[model samples]
Target: MSLVSKFATVGGATLISRIFGFGREMLMASALGVGPVADAFNLAFRFPNLFRRLFAEGAFNAAFIPLFARALEEDGEEGAKRFASEIFSTLFSVLVVLTALAMIFMPALVTTIIAPGLAVCVDDPAAGGNALSCAMRFEITVTFSRIMFPYLACMSLMAMVCGILNAYRRFFAAAAAPTLLNFILIGVISYALWIEADKATIGFLMSWGVLVAGIAQLAMVTLAMRLAGFSVALKRPRWTKGLKRLLVLAGPAALIGGITQINLFVGQAIASFKPGAVSILQYADRPYQLPLGMVGVAIGVVLLPELARSLKAGRLAEAQHTQNRSLEFALFLTVPAAVALFIIPEPIIRVIYERGAFDPSATPAVAAVLGIYALGLPAFVMMKVFSPGYFAREDTKSPMIVTLVSAGINIVLSLVLFPILAEQGIAWATTLSGWLNAVLLFLGLWRKGLWEIDGKLVKRSLLVLVSALLMGGALIAMMWELNAWLQPGDAVTTQIAAIAILVAVAMAIYFALTLLTGAADRTMVMRLVKRKRG
Candidate 1:
């Protein structure tokens, strides 16, 4: 299959998952709003999610895929399976211990890292609010976190299996697995709402749903692995040469892979000082995550394996072209997405989240956060594109160093800005830090002569930006023209239709401009589609 076609397979699945994710978030917004229970649930989920991203998706995949590809190239499927089994046994043992300890110390983890602000509000009289309420929220967060912590083990194992699948060019099951989480959550929330459950009850139900979803996701991917004629048997964990090397690379790749999550961790910690801030930022995050997951994630997943195979086969030019095209594809989609979000964040947020307990008053804050996040959207995607260049070469250290610097900057900025602009400040800090990470990754690849900016890429990138801006301008005019129909008080169907019209118009303009100006390669896209069909 062609590279773009592979990307489409993953991207298409991710798009479905993200759509369901939107449904989950929208339900949560109605059920919990930005209240204390919402804060508690979001904080609790973020805790395990943070670790899941760092260990499972980020570090494990970055360190594992290249080595797996090499094993397949050199020693065939048997060698790869042996390597995977060893790592699986070791990872399972470590995760068991980690999850056990984490649950045992759940309160400390909640108070210290997950939501320190809640702890302070509870203990410090000077901080002065409802201490009883704060303590309750704190306990709820701890309980919810403990319930969801086991999810980390499930997802981490799933990610390893998915890495194996991706290396084998089996993208659908892995890409589609995330939808199970959203599906389960949507059902849980729907039931909670149907029964008129209170906020605390809803939160508990959702946490348990997360654990169940993780298990389901793992089972789905594992079944896919077996069906693909690959299996990793349980074995005694050992310190083999391959295991030692994976650990060495994974340690650095953890930091490099989870930079975005790390920044979110920092932002969440800081935002916890204020009630509703965490939920607000999260609500804002969902809209942008759609594009990032569909485009950036698909590119990252597809590109890393492609680059590894190319480089392993001693095809430097093919690797370069892969990186360049991935970058082009990421920017082409994300730049326009960023433009749309920046232009119409309020309408989007309102349509998605303004009903039920989600007050109309909260729209402006969420919209502001979404707009700032939109500014960083392309950077986030670019980081995904460029980091694969380093990882495919089995060099995780360079990106690790870059990620650390970017994360540090994010910390400093968040600390400085949160006091001033509230959640929007955290949004800005994340955006700036993201751009820095993307730029450094690209420069690192270029300096090492691993990647070169071809003229086509350069030209196409500028034109993509121009097309996106033109779309943004048209959106601005449309918003003004349709102000009455897009209002919060308008009928839900009317508001949705208005947003839909705006999006349809925006897509039409952006695609037309890209096609007419040659920013997007129509012939290449057509050939990819035909090849996939063939």
Candidate 2:
């Protein structure tokens, strides 16, 4: 499949998944506001998600795709299948053992990372309001972490299998697995909310839902693999040379790919000093992630295999062209998104949330963080697209070093900025660090002469930015009236109607401006559609 079509296939599925994720968080905000219970959920949830991103998405895919593609190239379809099956068996055994160990050592891990989750259980009566009174509270979340951490193992294994399928040029069902994960989480949370009347028990329900969803997600992907006639079966592990290379390459890629997550962890660590800070960051980051997940991640996920195949065929120029186009698209789409978030965060938050337990007071605080994060949205997405260039070459160490530098900046800034700027400061640090990562990668790629682009892509990108600026200006002006109409005294239905109208107006303006400015012309889009036979 062409990169554009593959991205569309994956991006469309990812959009649905992200929308569902938004709904899941909305339910969560209503159920668990920015408080101790919410903190616990974030802590327990981050536990697995942290590693899942590091392994499944980052390290595993980086190492797996190039090798898998090469296998398919040299050994034909059957040889590649066997290699995948063997890796699956080894990974499953290791993950099972690791998950078991995690169930036992949950307390120590929680204490080290998310000490704030234990607030309710700590000996100090007043500790529930403090993020750090976690001395004894870690024990409470251990059970939840135990249930949830296993989800990482399941997801990591699934990611490996998915990488195999993608290498074989199967994108639909595998990309759709996350949609299943989102659906399962939504269902579990909905059921939990339906049954639970007590506030405290809500956390338990959410945690349980997360555990069930992980299993469901694993099943969904495995079943898809089965139907594709490539289901991985259990086999014994051997110290194979190929596997060793993957391990060596992936170790640093995992860490490198995990820079954003690490930044998130640093935020969480700093957030440990203040109540509601973790939840605050989480809630604020939700809306912005929609575009990131839909666009940035979709491109990255699809790009790896495309680049892998190109590199396998020794089409360096073709790989460079694809990378540059992906970079341009990411920049064009995400820059506008960043501008919107930067310009009018309150209305966006208010429109989606700020109802039920999520009060008006929560709006400004969340919006502040949202604005800060949006600043680096384009760079963040571009980083996702560009990093795959190196990953496809099995040069993970370069990205790893870049990621380390970015991570260090985040850590230092989080500590320094947290007190001065409060929740948003850590967010700003993250934004700056993301751009720093992008800058380093861009320089690295250019220095290596890995990317050379034509003129049209650059023109389109500049046009996109100009259109985005105009759209942002329009939204900034329009939202003031929107906020007025959606004011507290207005009827709830009227507020909803006003929000709908504002959203319509903003989108129409952006699209119209995009057309006029030649940001997304029909001709360019059509060219993207016409598959360039590699």
Candidate 3:
């Protein structure tokens, strides 16, 4: 499949996952609000998610895909399946051990990881509370997190197989696996609330739900793999030469790949302060990520296989063309979305949140985070586009180094700005860190003679902005008109209807401008359709 088409397939499925994810969060807001339970839930949730990104999305895929693709090249389907089984068995054992140890020692782990801001206020709210303070109790968050943290192990195993599946061009099952997590959590949370309304102590039920959901998630993906003809069995841990090689590549790649996520940790650590800060940032980030996750992550996943195949086939020119096109496409989609989000965060936030537990007072803090994050939107998307160049070569160290450098910048900025920006400072740190990572990667690639851009593609990328700018003007006007039409704390139906109209108008204007600026060329539109279908 072409890069665009592949991106569309994964991205379309991811878009569904993200939307369901939004619904899940909305339910969470109504159930937990920004209370201690919400804070604990946020921190506890980050534990599994952090590793899901670190091991599954970052390190495992960086190492696994290139080698898996190579096996497919040399040995075809059977050989590739065998290789994946071996990797799966080995990864499964390691994750089991890791999850066991983590659950056993989760309190200290939570204490160690949460920011002083959160942990401090979390302990004693009367005495200004500790940063890690939970609305329930510090132990409550820690205990709940222990139950849920096994998800890292489950998801890691699932992600590794998904990488193998992706190499086999089975994108839907792997991408769709995440939807199970959202749905399961949603159902679990709803039932927990319905049955135990009096002591909704949201954290207790929600945490339990996450653990059950993780199990179901692992089962779903494993079944999908079995149906796809993958086979596996338990075995003693033994590192073969291939596994060793993957370790070498994955170690740095994991570090580099985890930079974006690590930045979040830094932000979260800092955000634990000022009550509701963590939840505020989380909610604001929802809309901002709608485009990023759908486009950025989708492009990155597709680009890895696309470039790895090209490199294996000795098609350097095709690889270069693919890289350039991916970058252009990233710019085309991400830039406009960034502009729109940065300019109109409050309207978007008010539309989606600000009901039940989530109120209007929460809007600015979330909007602040959203706008700050917007500044790095293009860079974050392009980072995905560029990093695949190295992963395809089984070279993870360079990107790892680049990520460390960016992370260093993040740590520094967080300390300097945390006191000043307070809740939003953490958001600023993430934005700065993403751009830093992107810049370093681009410079490294150019210096190493890894990629070059086409002049015409650059011009085409510029046109994306022109139409986006025009659309932005129209959106600004609509948001102003809509503000008068709807109130923040209004009924869910009214808010939903207003948001629907706003999105429809913005999309219509954006689409109209795209046609005018020729952004939707016949070829690109066709490419987008196939991509979505996949």
Candidate 4:
């Protein structure tokens, strides 16, 4: 299969997952709205989800895949299996202890780490009689956090297995496994809505659904590994050189891998001071995540293994070309997506989330946050593209330092802005910090002579920006034309149809302009589609 073809396999599955996630979020918005229950649920889920991102996406992808590829290359199948078994046993033991401790100290974790602002709610003069309500929300958050903490263990194990699959170029099952979480949650939320469950009941059911989904996701990927003729047997945990090396690499890569999540974690911590802020930021996050997951994630997953294998084989030129093409592909899709989201976030948010208990009054706030996030969309994707250059070479420390600096900037900016702009300030802080991370990663690669901007890549990038801007202009015009049908009080079908027309028009204009201007061409695209893996 071509490299792009491999990317397509993962991207297609992620696209499916994102679509299901949209459904889940839509239902969640209707059921919980931007109320206290919604805040409790989102805050609770973020705690485990943060760790899931760190372990599953960050640590494993950054540290595990390249080593697994090395095991396959040097020690053959038997050695790789032994390595996997050893790592599996050790990881399982650690997760068991971690999950137990986290659950036992759930209340402290909730009040101190997850959201310290919630702890002071009862003491606030502004809270008054609402003090009791705040206390209840605090307890609900703690309960939900405990219920879902075990999910971190399931996801961490699943990530290790998925890393093995990626090393073997088996990407579909791992890419598709996330859809199961959305599927299960969608069903749970649907059932709640059908039976008219109250907010607290809905929150509890959804938290349990997360744990169940994590288990199912692990089983699916594990089954895929077995079907692919690979198995890691349970064994006594042993401290081996390989395990020691993985920890050494993973310690730094974890931060590099989870920089985006870390920034969001910080934002969530601060946003918790105001009711509905956490849920508002989350609602805004879903729309942009579609493109990020489909394009950025697919590139990160596919590019890392490919680059590692190329570098391992001493194909220096091939590795450089892979980096260039990955960046090109990432920008080609995400630039236009960012443009669309920035231009029409209000209409998009309204169509997806404006019904039920989600008040029309909340639309502008969410839209503002979404627009700011859209501005950072390409930066986020670029970080995904550039970080692999370091990781493929087993140089996690450089990116780790860059991530820490960016994170500090995010923290400083969030504190400076949140008091002034509310949630939008958090959005601004995240966006600015993202661009800094992307820039530093790119410069690190270039300074080391690991990557260079070829003329084709440079030319196409500029043209892609132009094409996206042209599409954004057209979208503004169309929005003005369709204003009557896109209103909040308009019929749901009418609003959806209007948004659909806008999206269809935007895609057509963007693709047409890219083709006309040679930002992308049929020959180049066909080569990407048809070229086999080197």
- TM-score winner among the candidates? 1
Clashing pairs in 1: none
What TM-scores do the predictions have? 0.98, 0.93, 0.93, 0.98
In terms of lDDT, the poorest run of 10 residues in model 2 is 128-137
Candidate 3 displacement at residue 243 in angstroms? 0.9
- Which ranges in model 2 have alpha carbons more than 4 Å from their true place? 116-137, 524-534
Candidate 3 lDDT over 1-534, as tens digits, reads: 666778889999989999998888878877777766777778788878888888788987788899988888999888876677677778888888888888887767776786455445555556585434344546766777887888788778878877867776778777777888789778877886787663235677777777777777778777877888775666665777768888888888777777777888777777776667778877777787789889987887788888999999999999999998888878877887887888777766776666677766877778788898998999889899888888998878788888888898898888788889886788888898899899889998889999887785767777888877887888778777877556666666776677678667877887777667766565768776797899
Encode model 4's per-residue lDDT on 357-461: one tens digit a residue: 899899999999999999999999999999889998899989989999999999999999999999999999999999999999998889988897899899999
**Whole-structure CA lDDT of model 3:** 0.79
TM-score of 3: 0.93
Better of 1 and 2 by TM-score: 1
Candidate 3 Cα misplacement greater than 4 A, ranges: 118-127, 130-135, 196-200, 489-494, 526-534
Candidate 1 local distance difference test against the native: 0.92
Which sequence of candidate numbers ranks them by TM-score, best first? Answer: 1, 4, 2, 3
lDDT values, one for every candidate: 0.92, 0.79, 0.79, 0.92
**Residue 353 in model 1: shift from native, Å?**
0.9
Model 2 Cα lDDT, one tens digit per residue, 1-534: 566678778888888888988888888888777776777778778878889888777887788888888878899778787777777777888898988888887777776665543444354656544435464235446766777888898789878877877776777767777776667667766776788655457777777777777777778777777787776667888778777878898889888777778888779767866767888999988898888888887887889888888888888888888987788778767887788778867766776676666777888899899999999888888888888889998898888899999999998998899999888988999999999999999899889988786786889888888888888788767777677686766776777787678667877887777777777756755575574632
